[model samples]
Target: MAGKQASVLVQYIAVRGDLAEKWPMGAIIAQACHAATAVMHVFKDDPNTVQYLSDLDRMHKIILKVPNEGELNALVSVLESNNKDFKLWVEQPENYPTCLATKPYIKTEIQDYFKKFKLLK
Candidate 1:
């Protein structure tokens, strides 16, 4: 995977694990938003890319509350852009729903957030 993509994945797993430790929903959402904003900065040259990443991050919060097809599809689109055959990573039954719902959003958020710090660019 690309450096950005790998970073996103690792950060997401860490966040998910942290959230699983009984963190409040609001806190989780805030963290996610921050991460998304950072991720958006990585693609500062393209506003649409930033918007898509932001939206995906927002949708990820929603997905945590309610899993849906559209959100999953959006995530798949983002992942595919970073790594072809990314779906293979999601194929494991244990990882299916959670990864499908959260990975893209977390990645987008992290990128956007870091970008704000001018670290990504």
Candidate 2:
């Protein structure tokens, strides 16, 4: 199961990377957020999804390493779209953990967003 999950995560990351390269920064972030959110949904109900979440965690770290308003805004936009309340919490640096905890929801929102955006087949 873990192996299968890992494979799925790898696929997701590869797709995300491709999107990042091809799309605008905001669009990439939006797509990544959507992808991560989809993974979260799968993770919540399927043990297979947990590995994908782990992949997302790693990707999140990479995203954080980037220094740009467009990137940050895109990331924050996804979070905000997932949870309106997150806007307030995200503003407070100390509440980062709380914001992290909301990743699942953010991920789920991203998944839905992807569907709406027609990023998913």
Candidate 3:
């Protein structure tokens, strides 16, 4: 198994579910986009990111929801403590910390950190 490679790389984005009640859908979606884009740019040189980006059609992303800003804030600490590479996007005009996006990583290695969240449906 020494030479085995992880075939599926996924990026995980977590958004604040409470925002749905306070903001328009477009605004919430934009925040997620900002976080995802920021992390990708920050880790553009990483091997997994490079491989994840190269396959444009197959790029995979899972967006989940945290109950509120408190949950989103806690996730930052969790990711930081675990040494996960990610971007926590704070909207400028309002200085609102909206969401976070993890750099593309092996699903099995990183999914556990996000297991508590539910898909944003």
Candidate 4:
């Protein structure tokens, strides 16, 4: 038991930084939240999601920021090419892409894809 590595599942949520110019803080946050919740619901049956949820207090999520919708869409394309499962949340009425969230994944398996993005402040 002493040598076993710790559990390190993570969910990455990237919100758009450019949205602040046209949207209020509350709406921007709601987009990220919606994306996060949507991914969880979409991938609820995934093994990692099951394990990640097993420990509610220890569940990990990395919130990062994208400069605008373009970067967000580009990231989505990359994820699609890699066959990674994720949810890209688009705001209704405006049809705006605001954020994206990858379902729970083993940290090391997907962390690199997000290195270019900074922590969402």
Q: How much does each candidate deviate from the true structure in C-alpha RMSD?
A: 14.0, 11.1, 2.6, 2.1
* lDDT of candidates 1 onward, in order: 0.38, 0.36, 0.92, 0.88
Clash totals for all models, in order? Answer: 14, 3, 0, 0
Which window of ten consecutive residues has the lowest lDDT sum in model 4?
A: 1-10
User: What tens-digit string does per-residue lDDT give for candidate 4 at 67-105?
Assistant: 898999999999999999999998888898889999998
Q: Report the poorest 10 consecutive residues by lDDT, candidate 1.
A: 112-121
Q: Once model 1 is optimally superposed onto the true structure by TM-score, how far is the C-alpha of residue 76 displaced, in angstroms?
A: 13
What's the CA error at residue 93 for candidate 2, in Å? 36
List the candidates ranked by lDDT, beginning with the highest: 3, 4, 1, 2
Residue pairs with backbone overlap in model 4: none
Report the C-alpha lDDT of model 3 over 29-96, residue by residue, as the tens digit.
99999999999999999999999999799899999999999999999999999999999999888897
Query: lDDT per residue, candidate 2, 76-111, as tens digits?
Result: 576566652222113134332111112233343344
Residue-by-residue lDDT tens digits, candidate 1, 1-121: 6875543432231134323345566754554455445444544455444444554543322323213334445555754665522221232344432222223333544443223111110
TM-score of candidate 3 against the unseen true structure: 0.92
Which pairs in model 3 have colliding backbones? none
Per-model TM values vs. the true structure: 0.31, 0.28, 0.92, 0.91
Instruction: Estimate candidate 3's alpha-carbon lDDT, on a 0 to 1 scale.
Output: 0.92
Candidate 4 error regions (>4 Å): 1-7
